[model samples]
Target: MSHRHVAAIDAGTGSGRCVIYDLTGVAVGSAQEEWTHSAVEGVPGGLDFDTRQNGALIDRVVAAAIRDAGLGATDIGAVSTTSMREGFVLYDANGEALWACPNIDGRARVQAERLTQAGISEDVFRIAGDWVSLTAPARYHWLKEFRPDILERARYMGMLSDWMATRLTRTFFTNPSVGSSSALFDLNTRQWSDHLFERCGLDRAIAPQVVEAGTLIGHVTPESASRSGLAVGTPVIAGGADTQLALLGLGRKAGQATLVGGSFWQMTVLTDYPLVDPSRAPRTLCHARPGEWMTEGIGFLSGYALRWVRDAYFEPILSAAGSDLEAFDLIEAMASAAPIGAMGVVATTGAPMQSDNWRQPPLGFIGFDGNTPEHALGNLARAVMETGAFLANSHLQKLEELTHQRYDTIQFAGGSARGALWPQIVADVTGREIEVPVEKETTALGCAMLAAVGAGMLDSIDAAFAAMASPIERHINPDPERNKLYRDIQNNWADVTMAASRMAECDLFEPIWQPPGAKFTSMTDIRKV
Candidate 1:
């Protein structure tokens, strides 16, 4: 095969990014487009995105990445796409998109209820693994029940990655990475669930034919060639969800784990078999590789929590700043000053922080006191970071039991990753040696690697990761002095968080609670120092 560079297009929750990677996996160029997701019908939480607008932006961003690479798109060996999982656009027989509702859109609550009423809902824990939430099965069922006319017109339904693959190659297909997030795919069978389709009244045919993560779907057609600057007939590969791709990019294997410290904070560890946790189900996604799954212990907050603290709790500090740079400096300085334990601080909240449980309000400072940093916000910042570590560790312990493997190190990535202090804090708080990637934006690199692997430019996913992976930026060894403090705090925090759920158990929307707390605490105390 002829040599070719890899191009990655990521249509994500917050923005769109196109990146070009050389054969060695070093990034040469990239471009990004950040768009605001306006609520449909001008109502609150009626979340939606313009698929066409995002689609056009992908086309433009790819062109920019190519231009920045000092080569035309035609120079690229292969193209692959990655995206946030579970959202889909309905397409007519002619490939026209109906309204593109994002995965978190709330318009389908009633539709979801209908599926439950139809006995379509199983134990959620047994058949499907973990928190089923608005996974693809429910999303497709929503269309069938609420928007039947559109459902009738849909010759195809697809995730953002699959849709882009279709746009580039004019063929509808899916890879295991995307399929794992869809409730339609049975974790045991590694194929679409006939039972789920029959109960939801969904046409399995509307879903694309499933393939492995590195499969080449087709070549770029002439129309896309003109718009994207990629040559006509250029190979396009079907890749994966952004998070899963990032896991692979971080060199995570079935026995290892990686953590992301971004808008959404998550820890993904490789598991030989799927774990069954009803409460943790919403956060879990099956692995793309057959008989291998990723036991993801994640939450919806982290860096975004920091952004919230800056805006709400610390808005006065931001407003008094002379400039943007000065304001950012002040925030960092505050985080630096905050002592490790945040001085008896308990819980620092942000952005509703919805789990499988109650809808907590935005930005709550629970267990506040006179000792709490009032004007001095360092305590709050430390608590926020500490909360992140504690929460992350919360999931890791469960995953270890489910996978029957222990993680020696945790890999870090994303915007918050630039802060060296956070890694040490994570290490001290979680008591794990931290590995941070030198090259940031690994999600982009992961997609490029997938494209290369799919294009047959690389032998296997492991080989692709080897070719594209970078050296570790820095290492943060856990401080034995602080580890004891963090361990006590982590135990208290976990138990307190658990105890407080009883106050919320009365709420209709909360997750069903079970006891014993999952043994995450023992792992903290038993860490090999």
Candidate 2:
């Protein structure tokens, strides 16, 4: 029988999911499981990716998805993978897993400082379009310093998605979209940079072969087929980074801006050229589509912050609801009932993106009146949601300055876009039209598009998207009065966050988040470029 379906495996920061889609882009089946990366003992910000455990989870999700589709494994024509970027896995000569860490891992502070102090960070940023903080070079140096034994036996390094593709086909290869995030690729060349390895004192031999997304890598091995419920000889395709792939699935054309809001909120603008910010405030990564590049600014843990508020303060509401979706709906309804400024409650949950000086103030709510409904949970939640919009507006301003272009409309995707209230808030805060697609899981859909291309069901990545991608389901227009109020509120929020950051500097409070090696000696040093 002719194969007419494709599968996508996605390993995200907080979860793992498998989605099966037919040639027409319709999702036939899906399964998802939440997972966590544990912090390493004695390491301040180290988060370890348990390969053995996560691998099992991946297997279970894939098998469950195929079963949910009510189709035989042989029906899947191709498989592709995508994941949270920056996280990587190491392998020994015999292909055994050595060590792995998630994207949020920050065990290499000293190594990152060494590179920065030596003035090598500028060179890496200039070539790779990324900083040294969470990239591969610093992590490799950390291994060399603290875990030399493991490094000695390691033969290859691959990103999380690359690891998934390798497990299926037993082929070690990486694509530019994720590879560029490692600080090991030459942005212009879209390949591994030998100079970067030499400068970082890392072995060049560990670099994997660079391939473009949607390229056919190899056939799935029998062992992987048995474990994942995939057919042997199924084609495995190289996939790109999650954000970039999500852009592809959203049909983002050149000169368009998109906000991907999930565990982290990424503000990305597509450009025809690989433009590096001279100030190094934003990150640049290769797009899933060849000859394209994306300048990105990130809001740290925006979605996670919202989740914390829900779990910590709204458990009663959650218990009363039938499902998480229902709970979120109720939360949105409450937020909608609150006035625009959220009753003067300013939430400093997310900071504006600064790749070179990444940090966040302590997550908090300020200026609430306990005597009035200003202290209500609905107002607090609305303030938290508004912080995400404030951060997005900040990033969009920076991107506009860098690109010398103004975006009149923005494409919003990811988990946050599913809520009508959040999207409207974003539109009002940014004073831009917001378009949300029918499918929120654009990352997995983009990976499936690549699978379709690799399986010869589509002519190219663009063709696959044109043939299968969903159309925009809704458009949100900013209310003029609300926009004016948000503009004033955002300014006050910025001032409050800066004061909070100073409190962290004084040791009176702890930062909600900061990258490894990020240090600001004074208030002036903490300012964005």
Candidate 3:
């Protein structure tokens, strides 16, 4: 049979998914399996990616997707892969996996602190458009300090997506979208920096060759084909980080902005040129497209926080409904009953993006009284949702200042966008129109677009997007009155969050979240920057 479809394998933070898409960008079949990274015993903030088990999971999903699509392996024309950024796998000289970790792994806190204290972090931000927090160098240093054997055996390193491609084709190559997250790439050149390797005491030889997204890397090997239910010699194309490709899938263009609200909320704005922030507050990342870049402001744990509220506080409703989708609808209705400001509830859960000095105070709610209507579960849930929007607004303003451009419309995607209330809140808070696409699995759709391009079914990425991108499902316009009120509420929330952060700094309360090796003595220290 002739090759008639393309496949995208996504290794996300929370799950592994395989989606098959036809030429029209419509998903024909998909399979997903949730997985978790295990915390390392006795290692503070350490999470290990079990490569052996996860690799099996990937194989299972790929085979299941093909079966679900009711198609033979020969029908898939090309395959591309995307994954959560900042997580990587190391390989030995013989290409055997040595060690792997996910993005949430923070075992290198001591090493990251040392780098920051030594002022090396500034140099890293200047060259790599990233900081030492959760980047590859600190992790590599940690391995060198604590697990020297793995470092000595490590001969090659690549991001999770690259590792997936390597599994199929036995070729190791990284694309800029994911490779740049390692804090080893020179933003100007979109390649590994020798200075960074030498300064961080890492072997430059371990870095893999960089490739642009959609570039054909290699063909699937017979061994992998047997295991993955893929045809031998099927073309394997280089893919990108999930967020970057998600932008492409949403049909975002240069000079546009998007808010990806998933486990984390990322406010990203694409630019034609790589623009580094002098303060290094926002992260700069390479776009999937060559010669393009993006500035990203992250809201940490926003989605996870929402999930926690549902599971912890709304369990009765969830259990009665018997499905998250239905239960969330009921929750949204209850939240709607709360006023625009969620009855003065200030939630300091998800922290706004601050790459230079990343940390968060204890997760809790302020401005609530016991058993009152204001302290109701509905209002509290709404506050958590509003906190996400508030953080996005802060990031958006910073992006506008850095890029010298105002975005009138914002594209919202990911799990949070599936709901009606959150998108409207984002539109109201940002004072911008929100466009939600019909497709929920945008990252997978974007990867499929790349696969289509790599297989020669589409002329270019732009062409693929034009041919395959989903239509806008709805356009949310900001309510002028609510937008004005949100501006004031957002300011109050910031002050409340800062106060909590100061409390965490003084050890009055433990920090709910802190980047690996981040140590802040006072909130004033960050403000002075």
The TM-score of candidate 2 is 0.96
lDDT of 1 by residue, 69-118 (tens): 89865688999898877666678888877767655555555555555555
- Give the per-residue lDDT of model 2 (tens digit) for 413-464: 9999998899999999999999999989899999999999987889998799
Q: Per-prediction TM-score, please?
A: 0.86, 0.96, 0.95
* TM-score ranking from best candidate downward: 2, 3, 1
135-217 per-residue lDDT for model 3 (tens digits): 99899889988999998888889999999999999888999999999999999999999999888888998899998999999
On TM-score, who's better, 2 or 3? Answer: 2
* Model 2: lowest-lDDT 10 consecutive positions: 520-529
Which residue pairs in candidate 3 have backbone atoms (N, alpha carbon, C) closer than 3 angstroms, thus clashing?
109-517
Please give the lDDT score at residue 479 for candidate 3. Answer: 95
